[model samples]
Target: MPTELRPLGVTCNIQCHYCYQNAQREAGNMGGNYDISKMLQTVDQVGMEFTLFGGEPLLLPLEDLERIWAWGKERFGKNSVQTNGTLITKEHIDLFKKYNVTVGISIDGDGELNDVRWCGNLEKTRTATSKTMSNIELLCESGIYPGIIVTLHRFNASKSRLPRLLLWLECLDELELKSCRVHLLEVETPMQRQLLALTADENIQSLLELYRLERELHHLKFDIFQEMRALLLGLDNKTTCIWNACDPMTTRAVQGVEGDGTMSNCGRVNKDGVDFSKASEQGYERYIGLYYASQEKNGCNGCRFFLMCKGQCPGTAIDNDWRNRSEQCSIWMRLFEEIESDLITQGYNPLSQHAVRAILERYLVQEWTKGANPNLLRLFLHSSATSYEREVMHAYLVENNISHKWSQGKLAHLDHHWEGE
Candidate 1:
């Protein structure tokens, strides 16, 4: 996971109505008054180049950014930052080029579609967006090629607004922007849900359409769908942390660094407040509890896809409650279904093949209680697992050797023997 350094914490220039950081800001977890020395010390101790992240990382002073970037360039070949794009200027672009910094911009859509990213009122919001658009254009003109991040909500990606969203993406494609990370709305409050969140049906249709759009576009790729297909292909490398059974407490998904050089959990899981040594510590409960949970009791049991989905991201958990499975559960399932069918039609041997699916599912749920996302491929290849772990976790062990279908029953019904039985 990439470590993120936040100089300004959750403080942003414009208030997006559905932003996850709002709760942190509300609880007075605002960032500022950071020490450059201490922040550098923390990163050096970790011994890696870090991504400058934020409420809006550009809110940091240019000299401060240059200082950090210079230090980063001296130590590591490259640096990175994920920003809202509104605050980026020509000087900032020059600094970015000097240090070889990779930039990522966050925008929902343009004009009326971006109303959810409210800057006090509609006119101000549009003006802010116009600045962001100009900055994006400037970055492209300067040969920056920043990756685009879009948060899908009713304001931007609803059934009615999707065409406009596509048109905007087409414009980005024309600009030669290649990579886009699309996030489903993280509905944190009742009001946001009602006003901005897409219905489950809407979310499903929007992404399916976007996937088709990706096929036709010369540039512009959605990271999520690509990651999903990668997971099915038994390729665990280079996928997002969400798919790998993220532990809510540890939240190793993204290593977040604070303004004062303290490490923090992923902001999505820190819904109530930004807790650290200053705040009380919470227990490691959610993901572990999921291990023994049964689908019959309204949880992720007997779901063959659990190995790949890992209950999705805990941040998107139902009601913003990490203990519960993701609220977008239905959407993930439908997308996985679509992708798996397509891969099968192409004669690709996806890990989710029915012949070995049940065994892997059964094995993964058992392994979950141990508090980790074990790689199914590693076990399949090396024959290095303990007796039981290697039993049916490998597809060949179950399909090539076993006499019965895993769906028929448990290990008792299809013990690891050749087809002779």
Candidate 2:
């Protein structure tokens, strides 16, 4: 199901160093407030499944959460919550069972890794992580399986750290935890400055190696990195990774409500001067309209990775490097190139598998012999089939000196013949 995330602007107990939300304080109450009833009405109108998130969503008074969950049950039939896990109590577990809410706990890795941010006293962070694990266990005992969202950073992406994490989780296998998800930290803000500034090649190598190891691990049932690797390598023949950010299908299509009730495009975009609470009251349509308008105005269409990126978090786009793709995209694309190069070396032709290599070869030979425009040649190659097919075709065309574009009439005729055949 397509998921929508609603941020409840409630304060979090722990102060993480790299928190994307400027959740530190309520400066003059500028963050604003959201009416839960209005928010629920909007969710109903959108007809999409919703997930509750927050500066720390669990900080929402349990009664408020219950009301939201009940309202959600009445409308969407299923709801979920993403929390830092410190606030989870037996009462929270009971409410989760009553509402059938799926829970996702945000814990980076082990004590050492988690303490990097979940930071206060090292011992306290470890204690909280252990308690959170217990909370996950309690929820599971109640038949509410919880997933862990681990943020990958310079510290946790180590080869040694990943194996340790997997082993630790395996040790906790009796708890019946749902699965663990990992996300690369994006270097888009001051909060991430330290992580971003650490440009050590060793760190990058460790992360890549860890990812490779994670893929080869047999005991783990769920590894997002594996899925990401497959998607990047074009291994998942049926699933196209060219997601439009504005499409409901895009995972990046998220709404973050801050503790102050102000809405931003996503967690990263919830920075200053991007309030949506007023328009949000007008409902989902208005909110989406604003988002799309901002996207277009920002010239995201011109991006090479536009189809895949969909202009991640306009607030981040505006505040930081507006033109930068998500850090995840960079990692994914790098892995994709590596896998594609490896496959090519191994005699696997992605185009041949897609059944377009022959057509592409013919086109490339003809175009090169005729001295066609490189741009036109590329446009034609792209038109012949899928993006991956187009990419392979372009590689062949470039190798043969075929132009990547076409003259208007010639391209039209060629396109007709290609489509007809």
**The best candidate in terms of lDDT:** 1
| lDDT per residue as tens, model 1, 15-114 | 9898888888889978776888888888888787799998889988899999999999998888999988888888899999999999999998888888
lDDT of 1: 0.77
- What is the Å distance of residue 106 in model 1 from its true position? 0.2
User: What number of clashing residue pairs does each candidate have, in the order they appear?
Assistant: 0, 17
TM values, all candidates = 0.88, 0.65
The 10-residue segment of model 1 with minimum total lDDT is 412-421
Looking at candidate 2, what is the lDDT of residue 91?
A: 90
lDDT of 2 by residue, 1-421 (tens): 3344444453467766666654324342233355776676666655677788766777777888899888777776777988888789989888888887888888876567676556478788888877876777777778887787776665665555656655665644546564666555645556565653234343455456655654455443345444433332222222222222222211234654433333345444434433433232211221223223433354332232222233433333433543433334444445545554654675554332333434543453344344331222243433446556555554644443334453432333222111101
Compare the candidates by TM-score and give the number of the best one: 1
State each model's C-alpha RMSD to the native. Answer: 6.5, 10.2
- For model 1, name the residue pairs that clash: none
